[model samples]
Target chain A: MNVAKRNNVTVTGQRGAPVVMLAHGFGCDQNMWRLVVPALAEHFEVVLFDYVGAGRSDLSAWSEERYASLDGYARDVVEICRELDLRDVTFVGHSVSSMIGVLAAAREPGRFARLVLVTPSPRYIDDGDYRGGFSKADIEELLESLDANYLGWSATMAPLIMGNPDRPELGQELTNSFCATDPDVARVFAHATFLSDNRADLAAVAVPTLILECTQDFIAPREVGAYVHAAIPGSTLVTLDATGHCPQLSAPEATAQAILSFTGAAP
Target chain B: MCRTEQEQEPERAGGDGSLTQDAAFTALLEDSAVDLYENAPCGYLSTLLDGKIAKINSTLLAWLGYTREQVVGRMSFTDLLTVGGRLYHETHYAPLLRMRGEISGIAFDLRAADGSRLPVLVTSAVKTGTDGQPLLIRTSVFDARDRRAYESELLRARKEAEEARREAEEARLRAERERERLQNVLVTLQRSLLPPVLPEIPGLETSAHYHTASPDRLGGDFYDLFSLGDGRWGFFLGDVCGKGPAAAAMTSLTRYSLRAAAIHDPDPVTVLTTLNTVLLERYTGREPRFCTVVFGVLEPEGEGFTLTLASGGHPPALLLRAGGGAEYLPTPGGVLVGVLPHPPFTRTSTVLSPGDTVLMYTDGLTEARVDSGRALFGDGALLDFAARLAPATAKDTITAVTGLLHGFGDGLDDDTATMAFGVPASGAAGKPA
Candidate 1:
C-alpha cells in the first residue's frame, strides 16, 4: 500500500524545517487549506493531504466498515506519518479533524510535537450541561440535506460549476474535480462526523496544543471551542475575527499568523 | 360611427401621427423593462462577498415573506436558510463557490418569515471587478417543490430495486444448494442398490464398473456377485425400465428378490422365474414397472468354471476365448420379465477354459451414440471391441471396457453396468491372457 498515494499527500516548503501537517475535516478535501498554505509554507515544511474518499485521493481504498467511525480516519493519518517518517510535527486540523488529530497524537505521541485545532468541536450534538450546540433532530436534518444536494456532488452539476467558458483559465485548475465525492462514501463520512462524540478522547492529548476559534460560527459555537480548550490541559486558545466555521478561507492571514505564532516559526 | 370618424381623422394628419405613435411606443418600452425585472418568474438577488444581501428583486422578497426594508442590508444569505441548509451552505456550498467562482443547481431549503420551509434550487456566480479583483455575488433562485417530489420518488424506487435484486440472488443460491443436497442423496441410494465389493471366488478373478450419466437422477442399472452356498456363486446384472425414484424402487426390489431366490434354488432358470413373479406381483399397475436381467450360477469344474445362464429379454453375454477370439453366448426366445404371468425365458450353458472370460452388460453400452450422434455403437461394435481384448484377464477386460465407455463422452447418455469374470491361465497367474 502506497500510503502517500492513497491519501494524496502533498509536501512543500523548506525541506529540513519543522513539519506542519494539515488535516482537513469532512465535506471538503485538502483544497480547503489552499488559502493558508502559502503563508505556512514559507516558515515551515508544510504537508497537505486529502483523507481517503475525498479529493483526488484513491477512493478505492475507502471501505464503509473502516470509515464508519473516526478511528478509520485517524488510521489514515498515522499511516501517512509513518510512511514519510515525519517526526516532531505540528498537526493542524479543522472542524471534526481537530479531534482526529487528538486521536492520532495519542496513538503515536512521538510523531506529533504540537496540535492546532481550528474551529474545533469534540462533539456536535448537545449534552446535558456541555452544550455542544445541536439537537439530535438537527443532525438527522443534516443527513437529509446531504441527500437533497446529491446532484451537487454528481458529475452533471460539477461540470456546470467547474467549466467557466468566460474565464477559461479558471476552468483549468477547477475542472470537475472540486468536492465531487462518491455519494455513498459521503454519506458514511457525514454519519461519522456529525454523530460522533469524542469528548473523552481530548484528555489523552499530551502534546502542546493551540485552539483557534471563529468569533461567530453556527456549526462550532464559541462554547464548544471553550469546552475543547478547557478539556485539554495546558492548551492555548485564540479567537480569530472571522465569522464562519472556516477561518482559513474567511480570514487566511489571521489563521496563518496564529498557527505560526504557536509553533514559533514566524520570523 | 363617431369613434370611427375620429380615429380616421388622426391617420389623415400623417406627419403629426408619426410623432404621437413614437411617444406612446417609448413609454410602453420603459414600463416593460421595469416590469420584467420586478415581476420575473424566478427570484433574483445580489450579495456582497460575505453574503450580505445587497439587492433583491420583489419576486424573491414575496417568496420569502419579507419586505424590501427588512431584507436589504439587514440579513446575510445564511439567515434565510434553515438550520441544516445553513450548515450545508457554509460547509459545502460556500466553499465550493469560493474555489470554483460559480456553482449551480444546488438544492437548499429556505426559511420563510413564518418558519415554513421552501425547497429551492440556487445558482450563484461571483461578479469580479474590472481589475480582476474581488466583487459581490449574483444569484438566481428557482422554486423546486415539484422537482423535489420527483427526486424523492426516484430515490425510493432505486432503494426498492436494490432490495429486490438482493432477494433474487439469495433465492438462486438457495435453489443451487437444494439441488446439491438432492444429488448427494441419490448417489447414496444408488450405491446401496449395488454390492459394496465383488465377492472373491476361490479360483476366479472378477471386476465390475457402473457409469451414471446424471447425478441428479438415480440410474436403474444394478450388478452384484454373491456366494450362494456349497462352492456355488449366483451373479446377475440387469436394468429396470425408466429413470428416477420410481425405477430406483423397482431396481432395489429386483436385486434383493434375485438374491433371495438364488438362495432358495441355485438353478439359473428357477432363480430368474422367482424374481419375475415377485416383480409382477408387486408393481402391476397403470404404470407397470418391468426389467431385463441375465442370472447365472458358476461352480468350479476341474480348474475352470461351468456357468449356467438364463436371460429374460436381456442382451446375450460375450465370451472371450483364450485362443484370441470373442463371440456372444446366444439365449434366444426370451421375453421381457414381469410383463406376463407365464413368459418364456431362455437358458444356456458355457464352459470357461483357462484364461477365458465372460462379460455381461446392460444395453446402455451397445446403444450409446457414436460419430457425433450420427450412429449407435451397436452389438456388432461391442463384439469387435471384445475380440480386440480377447485372451485378456477379467480385471484388464473391465478396465479396457470402462475406458471405451469414457471415450463416448457426451454421446453416452444412459446408465451402463459391466461385470467380467475369468479363470487364470497356467503360466500367467494375474497377467493378461
Candidate 2:
C-alpha cells in the first residue's frame, strides 16, 4: 500500500515546516489528537493517522502474521518515512505508540531527529528486578473486563479517569470509537501492548527524546515515566500537571507548550 | 350519618371539618411513602458525587446486616464490593457511570456484614441539578443468585464443547496415519510384483527400468527376461488394463503363464498363443482383463543375436543399428490379448549385430505429455530420440531414455516401462569382428 493510505495519514502544516507525525494509542483512533493537533499544526507540519485496525484504514490490508508483533507497526513507521521521503522527522507517540516510535528510531536513526513519548511504558506487568507498577493478576482482570464488555469498559473507564465530564463530547466520542475497533484486533493489540518487554530497546534510541509524564495515570504510572527517561540516552522528562493519561484531552494547552518547548530546546 | 365517635373525633379536633380530614390524610400519606422506600423488595441507596454513601434503605441494610449509621458517611460504594469486584467497580463500573451518566445490569459481588459474598446486579444513574451539574448518584440493587447459577451452566457446556473438539482433532489425525500406513503397504506390494533381478543373458547386454507416477498405488507395467534351454532366451514387456491390487493379480497370472508356456514351446507365437488361451479361460467372468504385449525369442548366432518378436496391439520395437541407422521393425495385424477368443497375433524377425541396440517400451513414454501439458510426446518424437541414440549400448540407451523422462517434469503423469538389449563389439574394432 502507498504510505499515506496504509496508516490513514493526513499531512497538514506550513509548506516547508518540519514534519511532526502524531501516532495515537490503542483505545482511540487519530481522533485522540484532536485537541493537541490544532496547536502543533501552526508551528510545524503535523501528520495524523490511525493504525490499520483502529479507524478508517483498510482492514483488508491486515494479516494476522504480519501484525503479530509490534515490529510490524515499526515497519509501518519506517515505510511511511520512506514513502514520503521525510527527513529529520519529529515522531510523537502516545501510550503504546511511544514504544513503537522508540523501536522505529532505533532501527533507522538517520531518518528521525527527535522522539516525544506521551505516557510511555515499555512493560506494564512488574517482573522481579523491574517495577512496572501492575501485577499480572491485575492485567488479567483488565483483560477479563475487556472480554466481558469490550468497548463498555474502555469507553466509560477512559473518560472518568481522563476527567472531562464538563465536555460530554470527549467521552461520548471515545465510547463510540471503542466499539468501532474490531474486537479481534483490539484483543491482539492488548496482548502486544501489556505483554511486551521492550526495556532493552530504550538504550538504542540515539535521538534526543522528550518524555511527557502525567499525574495520577492508572495506565502508566509516574515511576514508568522516570524509568523511560533514565534509560533513553540524552532524554528529557517533563512531568505535566495534567491529571490523566491523555494530557492532550485533559490539558491540551500544557501538552502543546511542553512539546513546543522541547523541539525548540532540543536542537 | 350514624353519629359514630370515630367520625365525630375529626370534627371535634378542628372547628372546620374539611381541614381536619386534610391533616389526617397528609400524615397517613407521609408515613406510607417512607414505609414503601424502607421495606421495598429490592435495595436502594444514594451516594454523594464523591461515591460516599449519603442515604441507604433499611432493605439494603437488612441484606448486608449493617446498621444505617455504620454504612452511611463511612464507606463509598466501592468499599462494599469484594476485592476483585472492587477493582472492577473502580476501573470499569464507576468510570462508565460517570462518563455515560448511567449504567445498568452490571454484575458485581457485594461483601455482606459477616463477610459472606452476596451476588447482586446493580443499576446506577447520576443525578443532575437544574444547572446540569451532577450532584449525586442513585443506585438500585437486585439479588442475582439465580442468574449467576444459570450463567455458570454455560461454562460447563463450554468445557464439554472443548473436549468434543479435541477428540475430533484426534480422530482426523488417526485417519491421516492410517492413510500413510496403507501407502507403505502398497509400496512393498508394488516392489514384489516386479522382477527381483534381471536374469543374466550371455552375449547380450540387458537393462530395464520402471517408473510409477504416484506412490499410493502399484503400476500395471511389467517386464522380464528369462533364459530358455539350449542357447535360447524369452523376453516380454506388457501393460495390464488397470492399476491396483486387481491389476497386480492379472499381471502375476500373465507373467507366470508366459514363463510356463514359453518353456513348453519357446517360439514367440506359440508362447503368446498359449498364454492367451489360459487368460481367455480364466478371465471369462463378468469383469475381464486385457493387455498389450511384445514377446521375443532370442538365439545365439556368430557375432550377433537373432530376435523373433510377436506383438499384440503393441508398438513395434526400435532397432538402433551399429551403422547408425534407427527404425521401427514393423509387425502388423496384431490385436489386444485376452479380449477375443481368437485374437489374431503377428510376429517379426530381426538381427542385433555388434554394438546394435533393440529397445522396447510401453506406451507411457511415447504417449506422455511433455510441452507444458499442451502436446504429447508422440511416435514422431520417439523416432527422433532413437535416431539420436543410434549405435548405443543397452545400459546407455536405458539411461538416456530415463533422463528424457525425468526432463518431462510435471507433464509426464503416467507410469512407464522400458527395456533394451545390445550385442557388445570386440575391442580394437568398432564393427562386428
Candidate 3:
C-alpha cells in the first residue's frame, strides 16, 4: 500500500525547506490543522494527513490486529516518513497524536530533529501517587457517551459529510470535516488513545521536544504537562493562555507562535 | 383607525401614524421574547469561554430547583454535573467541543438543588464575533430520563442472553460425559462374553482370534474349543446374522448345545444337525434367529489329529500341507443353519499331519473391506496368503492372519472369528518363523 495515499497526505509550502509534519488528535481529522498550517507554511514545508479510518483517507486499509495499539499508529507515521523520504523533520502532534510522535521519534531517532506536543498526556488514568485527571470508571462512561453520540453523529452527518465532498454544496453546510469517521473505527481509536501508557518511553526520546500546555486543558491538565516535561530530557515547556484543550482551534495564533519559536522558524 | 390616527397626529406635530404603530409593535415583540426565552421546551444557557455561567433561562433554573440568584455568575457549567458526569465531560466532551466548535448529545447527570440527579442531553456551540473569534459558548439541554431507562433495560436483556448461552454449553458437556461412561460399560460387557484363553488340546497346537467391529454394540461372532469325551475334542466358529443382546443370547445357546450334541453322538454332521433343530424350534413364530457355522470333531492319531468338519453355509477350511502347499477343503451344498427345520449339513475329513495347519473361519474374513471400503479382501487373497505361509504351525498361521486384519485400519467393518489347529512338526516348537 502507498503510505502517502493511505493517509491522504497533502504537502504544501516552500520546496526543499525544513519539513514540519502535523498530526491531529482524537475526535478530529487533518482538517483541524487549518488555522496553524497557514502560518507555518511561510518558512517551513508543512505536511498534513489523516489517520486511517478518518476523514477522506481510505477506510479499507483498517484492520483490528494492526491497529490494536498506539504502536500501530506509530508504524504508520514511520512509514509515512520513509515513503516521503523525510529527514530532520519537526513533528507537530495534538492530544493523542503527541504520544504517537513520541514513539515514532524514539524508534527512528535520526529522522526527527524536534518534537512538539500539544496538550499531551502520557497516562490518562489517575494512579495512586499521580494525578492523570481521570479514573478507570470515568473512561468507561466516556466510551458509553461516545457510543451514543457516534450513533447520532453518523445518522445526521453521513450524507452531508461523506457524499458532499464529491458534489460540493454551494452554501449552508459546514465545510470542516472534524469528527468525520466511521463510528466502529472511532470506537476502536478511542480505546487505543485513552487506554495507552507511554510514561516509560519519555526518557528514550533523545530529540529536543517542546511541550505546549494549554492553560485550562480539561484533557491534559497542567500537572500532566509538568510531569512529561520533567521526564523528557532537554525538553522545553510553554504554557499557553488558551482556555481549552485544543489551542490549535481555540487559540491558533498563540499555538503557531510557540511552534515557530521552538523550532527556530521565522515568526 | 389609520385615518383617525393620522388626523390626530397632525394636531400633535411630528407624531406620525407609522411612528405610533412602531412603538406598539416593539412593546409586543419585547413581551414575546421574554415569554419565549423563559418558557421554551429545552433549557438554554450561555457560558464564557472559561465555562463560567453568563446567562441562563428560567426553564433550566426550574429543572434544577435553584433560584436565578444562586446559579447565575456563581456556578460553572461543569459544577452542576455529578462527579462521574464531570469527569467524563472534562476528559471527552470538552476536548471534542473545542476541536469541532460544536458538540451534540452529550449525556450528563446534573445534581439539583435538592440533591437529586437529573439526566440531560446537552449540545453546545462556540458563538463567534464578527472578527471570527469565539466570544462565548451557547448550550441547549433536553431531559434524557426516558432514554436512560430504555438503555438500562437493553443492557439487562443482553446480560440475560449471555447467561442462557453459558448454561446451554454446560448442559451439552454433561451429556457428552454421560455417553462416554455408557460406552465404557458396553465394552466391559462385550469382553466378558468371549473366552479369556483358548483351551489346550494335547498333541495338537491350537490358536484363535476374534475382532469386534464396534465397541458399543456387542458383536455376535464367537469361537470355543472344548473336550468332548474319550480321546475326542469338539470346536466350532460361527457368526449370528444380527448383533447386540439378542444375538449374544443365541451364541451362548449354540455353543453349549454343540458341545452337548457332539459328546452324545461324537459326529460333526449330527452335532450341527442338532443345533439347527434346537434354534429352529426355539424361534419359529418369533424373530427368526440364524447363523453360519463350521463345527469339527478331532481324534488323536500318531503325533497328529484326524478331524471331521461339518459346514452350514460357512466359508471352507484351508489346509496348509506338510510339503509347503495349501488348498481349500471344500464342503459345498450345505444349507444355512437355524433357518430350516431339516437343513442338510456337509461333512469333510482332513488329517493335521506334522507341519500341517487347518484353519476354519467365518465369512467375516473374506467380506472384510480394504482401501476405505472401495474393495474387499476377497477369498482369493486369503488363499494366496495361506500358500505363502506353507509348512506353518497353528500359532504361526493365526499370527499372520491377525497381522493382516490389523492393517485394514478403519476399513475392516465386520466381526471375524477364526480357529487354526496344527501338529507343530515334532520339534519345531521353539523356533521363530
Docking class of 1: medium
Best by TM-score: 1
Minimal lDDT window, size 10, model 2 chain A: A156-165
Residue lDDT tens for model 3, B35-141:
78888898999999888899999999999998888988998898898655665565457656776688877778788999998888898999999998788999999
TM-score of 3: 0.60
What lDDT score is found at residue A190 in candidate 2? 65
**Mind giving the per-residue lDDT tens digits that candidate 3 earns over A81-168?**
9999999999999999999999999888889999999999999888789889887777776666555554244445554444233443
Residue range B1-433, candidate 2, lDDT tens digits: 2246447675465457756766777666666878889888899999986567999999999999999999999988877875445545544465456556887877777889899877788999999999997889999999988886676576558668989999999999999899899989987887776787787776788899998788887788888888888778899999888998999889889989988988888878887788889889889889889988899998888778899999988888898888886899888988888988888888889888888899999998988897678899988899899898887888889999999889888777778899999998652233323
**Alpha carbon lDDT of each predicted model:** 0.87, 0.79, 0.82
- For each candidate, give its TM-score against the true structure: 0.85, 0.57, 0.60
By descending TM-score, how would the candidates be arranged?
Answer: 1, 3, 2
Summing lDDT over every window of 10 consecutive residues in candidate 1 chain A, give the lowest-scoring window. Answer: A157-166
The parts of candidate 3 lying over 4 Å away from their true place are A5-8, A52-68, A151-191, B1-31, B82-103, B113-115, B130-133, B155-433
Per-prediction DockQ comes to: 0.58, 0.06, 0.15
Task: Compose the digit string of candidate 1's lDDT tens values, residues B146-234.
Answer: 99889879988987998999999999999999999999999999999999899878678899999999999899999999998788889
TM-score, predicted candidate 2 vs. hidden true structure = 0.57
lDDT agreement of model 1 with the native = 0.87
